[model samples]
Target: MFSILIAGRLPQINFQQVSETQFVIPISDIDHVNHLVVFMTGQIPFPENYGGGGNWPSAEGPSWIFLGKITNVKPSAIFKIGKIKDIESKIGSSLAPTLFSGFQHQTAIPTDGLLGISVEPLSQLDQQIQPHDITPSTVASNVEFVSKMLNNFVNYVTSFVQNVPGTSEQIVPLSIIQTWYNNFQRRITENPNFWR
Candidate 1:
C-alpha cells in the first residue's frame, strides 16, 4: 500500500497494489481529474538476454512505462490522454490525463518512483539518482518536455469541461497546476519520495 498526493487537490490518495508495484487509483475516488492514475515502480528482472515469452514475468507492467523508467533510472513521469464512454453513450469517463511514474535510474534491484502520464517525452524527475550521470542538457530537455505537456494538459482540461456531458465548468485550480509543476521541480531537485 502507498499514499499518493497530487499538488493543489487530491492529497494523500491511498492506492493498493494491482500487481507487484503497479497500483491503479480509480477515477471515482478522486475529486479532480477523470482518468485513472496508474502508478508503477520496481524493476522486473528480465533475463540478461531476453529471448521471448516465459522469460518475463506474467505480471509485467506497461512496456513504455517500464522500459522508459529502467533506461533513465531517475524517477520520471509520462501521461496518456484519452476519453472514456459507456455503452449507454454517457460520459463514463472524465477524459483526464493518466499519470505514470518510473523508478530512479536503471538498476537490477527494484527502486523508487515518480508521477505523470501521456505521450510527453520521458523525463527524469529526480536528479540524485546514482550511477547514471545525466547531462545538464538532458535535464533541460526533460524540463522543457514536461512544461509543454503541462500546458497541453491544462488546455485539454479546459476544453474537456466545456464540451463534456454532465460536467460543470469546474476548472482545476491554477494554484494546483502551479503546485504540480512545483512539486515536480521539487522532487527532481530534492528526490524526496515521501514514501521513505
Candidate 2:
C-alpha cells in the first residue's frame, strides 16, 4: 500500500521556459510545500520570487508550479530505483539502493544517493502542494535528517534487543535487523514527526 505524498489539482498554473533545461510556473496555493518535486526525476521546482524573496510560497504569495506530473499509482521497486538514479545523476550525488522485506534482496553501501530502505512513500498531490524550491543545502540537510532518523531507529532496536533473554553475547541476526528496520521505516512514514 503506497500513498503519494503529494496529490491534488493545481489551479491557475502557468508554465514558462527559463532555459534549455529549466522552467518556471506560477501556482496558487496557501501553504509551504515540502518534499514535492517533479515526478520521476525528484527535480525540485525553483520557486519564483514575487512580491518577496521567500524560497517557498507563503499564504500571501503565488506558488510556482513546475512541469511534470506526480501520479497516484504505487510505484514499482524498479520504478522507484530509476527515479532515485535520476535524482542522483542530476545532483551529482552517489546514492546506493537498499530493500527490505517483501522484495528482492539487494544490498549496496550508500555513498551518495538515498538509503533506499528508508525511503518514504511518494505520490502526486491531489491538490497543488505548497510551493517550495529545492536547494543543495536543503538536500544535504534532508540527508542528514534521514541519517539521524535511522540512528534513532537503531537505538530503538538496540534497546529492544538488550531486553531479549540470553542474547547479550550473541550477534544480532540479520533477520532481526531487517525486521526492526522495516518497523522503523513504517513508523517514520506513518508519523513524520522527524520533519518537525
- The most accurate candidate by TM-score is 2
- For each candidate, give its TM-score against the true structure: 0.22, 0.28
Model 2 Cα RMSD, 1 decimal: 17.9
Output the worst ten-in-a-row residue range by lDDT, candidate 2.
Answer: 50-59
lDDT against the true structure, each candidate: 0.31, 0.32
In candidate 1, where is summed lDDT lowest over 10 consecutive residues? Answer: 50-59
Over 1-196, each residue of candidate 1 has an lDDT whose tens digit, in order, gives 2233444555434443333334333233223433222232333332232211100011123221221222222222222211111211221111111123332222232322322222223232122121111112267655766677667557645653433357654655566667666766564334322212
Per-residue accuracy of model 2 over 1-196 as CA lDDT, tens digit each: 1112223653212333333332333332323333333322223322232111111211112322111232323222211122322333432221111112222122232222111111222322222221122222367767877788778767766765534566556345677778877876675444434344
Q: Which stretches of candidate 1 lie over 4 Å from their true place?
A: 1-7, 29-72, 78-196
